[model samples]
Target: MSEPYEYWLLDLDGTLVDVEWDYVRDVFDTVGDRLDRPFTDAEAETLWHGLTGSRNRQLDAWNVDPERFWTTFHDVEDPQTRAESTYLYDDAAFVAGLDEPVGLVTHCQSFLTEPILDHLDIRDWFDAVCCCTDETGWKPDPEPVEGVITDLDVETTEGTGVLAGDGACDVGAAWNAGLDAIHVDRHGPHQRGHCVRGDYRVDSFDELDLP
Candidate 1:
């Protein structure tokens, strides 16, 4: 048998939570409404595929600050309402089932991550949580992944760490960080053919057989 990984770096958002697609659609619609140029579903798909850049670019295009956009989104009152709009996936329980050290490395901001975890009551399951907003760079950049690997004190040369995520950026980040990558395809279609490759591809956490 292959040696078990010493550390497991997991992704949030689509990987662990079933972020209500309607909520995302609503956010995009809100942005479109604010900009007076509503997007078609096709345009929305393109924007979502380019989220890491499109978000900032959209903010720039609108002459709005990205920070302001996020702040306003999170400031929405009615925690129960927000919770109702989002949901934790059944696979999230798999994290709690893992026996090895597990850390979360996500592109989401702490403000958003904290609430999601709190709602699921799975905050304590992670040994570390690294948010891109807390770092100088985001995923596909490796720095954030490196930060989590460093924080967990895992030896990179040992090849005993795996980064699991659903985006090309996540695979790229794992490759750049020199860790094994596991691609989770939670969304309809994954655009991983052009970007970084993964060591394994799984549809859900229940399928993960580490090592």
Candidate 2:
């Protein structure tokens, strides 16, 4: 028998689309310059790795005003510039078109997320789209996922839903929220080692044996 999942909660960046990190690096570097401190390539790499979390500590350490920095960056950043560079993965459409209710849970800002979805022409596919810009907690906290499920008017129960993404936080969020997890390892390295615990691991959506 197939697993009884009524919904599929998915991550946005790195899962649905591979955003151009080069443009992202430019944005971060621009923010650093606005704060009167230029971020080195190494610093930019580290920041890129922690895109899902808060950077208040780093801002404080650099004596930069967090609010001003983000406000200025967002105000100056053009959504189209970034959205034009982002492309959906080969299986993104197929997965999004699945019969089950689909929802998005991402730490990406709404201003960016909304336009990116529109650009990809998949905005209407999701039953719910939760962005961290609204203050909904990011993955590993379960609030964003829970919020999306609630918005979709679905009950959260064991075997009722699955969370799929390309990172550990996606799996952790599913575990924390009592949902099954599928880790999409698009890279070859993750296929060998068992780093993050997930119910299923696949290189692409084609390999995902959804119930």
Q: In terms of TM-score, which candidate is strongest? A: 2
lDDT of 2 at 44: 60
Question: Model 2, residue 4: what's the lDDT?
Answer: 64
Return the top candidate by lDDT.
Answer: 2
Query: Over 4 Å off in model 2, which ranges?
Result: 1-4, 40-42, 49-72, 186-194, 209-211
Listed in order, each prediction's TM-score against the native is: 0.79, 0.80
lDDT of 2 by residue, 172-194 (tens): 99999999998877544433234
Model 1 lDDT per residue over 119-172, tens place: 878888898888886444788788888888778887778478888887777888
**True-vs-predicted CA distance for residue 50, candidate 1, Å:** 5.2
lDDT of 1: 0.71
